[model samples]
Target: MTIAVVWLEDDGLWCVSDTRISRRGQGGGVQIVTDAGAKIYPLNVECRLLTVERELYYGRRYGMVFAGMTAVATQTFATLSGMCQALQGASRQDIPSLRDVATLLSKLVELYVRDFRASTTLADPGVIEILLFGMCPVSRSYEIWRVSDQIVEGSLHVAIDQQPARTGDVVAIGSQVSRFQEILAELKQKTENTFRLPKIAVGQMADASRGDVGGAVSIGICNQFGFQTYWSLGLTPHGQGARLMFGVDLDDIGWVGPVVISGGGMA
Candidate 1:
């Protein structure tokens, strides 16, 4: 299991995820592994193969953070990659809209479920949830769409729900979502919260049972400028030190500053 958190602030969209994977052992106990898993995948990128850390925030204006079964997540990434390749081959004017992308993702999950049911007798493929966040070129606003799939009557059911985030909206998914919500609420009640929001979210997940959700936390931001990594475990020690000391590298990642959403092209 994994924990992923996404929040919309005045600046842009912030996403965070923990890196831990678990499986059932021969004794029927769960075995937890860490430091070699990632749950965030940036969409709309130009790359032949997607590398979880390096390519996730590369040349992306949109991205998706996922939690749940790793097999389902891998299939979802493949579907998105294929869609992106198809879009790249089309005319600039033929690029799919954010809404269209969300629709396509839902359909892809539906198909995956169908195939899973055909090949296996498992009633469910495991819980799968995806949060799609990005800037809408047409509306000039940041939007978050929740895409989820569940097993219902031995078949997979998919749902797509979307909402335009106002400032201070927060969303989280995975096995530790309830804990995250509790932390957020407690922080809100405190007049002087010392912890960074993402850190707090990740910390709680890391403290869960047998540390099923423990590991380094990765973060990415998306806005009018584009998508870029705010923090990643894959970064070199030097890169991590630089960011901790001097915030984000605006020169390299492009700064959004305080953007006003107007119906226009990317800044």
Candidate 2:
């Protein structure tokens, strides 16, 4: 399991996630084996689709952060990425709404669960919960949605719930939710907590969770200026590449030239 946190600050939207991906061993034990996994996908120029003329076209400038079952999460991300590419090539007004995105994801999870149930005779399909965060271009705000699938009435039932972040609000998902709440409460009690960073709180929770949640913390910020990586593991190469190709440093503070939101009228 992993941890993902999303919040709205004065400047923009902040997202943080741990890179630890665990698995069950042959002896029926869980193992924390890697720290190189990415939990945040910056939906900017890096993920753009190329046209037949070999020209690059921009998609939505946002970040998608997730935490849940690895198999399902990865598959969902792949499907979403494909959909984003398709949307980019479609009509300019075809941009998907936040609810549309959530619904599509929920349907994907339901279909996966249905296929699993059909293949296995087991009564329980187990529990799967995926938390998704992204910026809604139509609403111009950061939204968090939870997609949960479980065995209900001996069949798969999926539900998608959405919450829009307000200024100073904190939202968290995955194994470290409770821990994040405790830290948030403590921070609220302090009189001088205005300058605290969300990444620091998430990093502290990951560190305290031992191996349950760990690895280098990855962060992304999205707002009117567009989405950009605040910090991430092994980001130097990516930063250099962006600078070379886009003429903007991905690591630079307040850098807005790296990504362009097409048809949304925000350049």
- Candidate 2 ranges with C-alpha deviation above 4 Å: 25-29, 44-58, 88-91, 116-127, 232-267
Question: Distance (Å) between predicted and true CA of 164, model 1?
Answer: 5.1
lDDT of 2: 0.62
lDDT of each: 0.65, 0.62
Q: Clashing residue pairs in candidate 2, if any? A: none
What would the TM-scores of all predictions be?
Answer: 0.73, 0.72
Per residue, candidate 2 scores C-alpha lDDT tens digits across 1-267 of 677877878667777777777865668656876655677775532223345553344455666776656666677778766765555434345456666777877888777667765775645345456655566766766777778776767656898888657777777777667877777677767756655456667767655646568655666667766676644323233333221111122345344578632211101
The lDDT of model 1 is 0.65
Q: How many clashes in candidate 2?
A: 0
Summing lDDT over every window of 10 consecutive residues in candidate 1, give the lowest-scoring window: 241-250
The per-candidate count of clashes, in order, stands at 0, 0
Q: Candidate 1: misplaced stretches above 4 Å?
A: 45-60, 88-92, 192-198, 207-211, 232-267
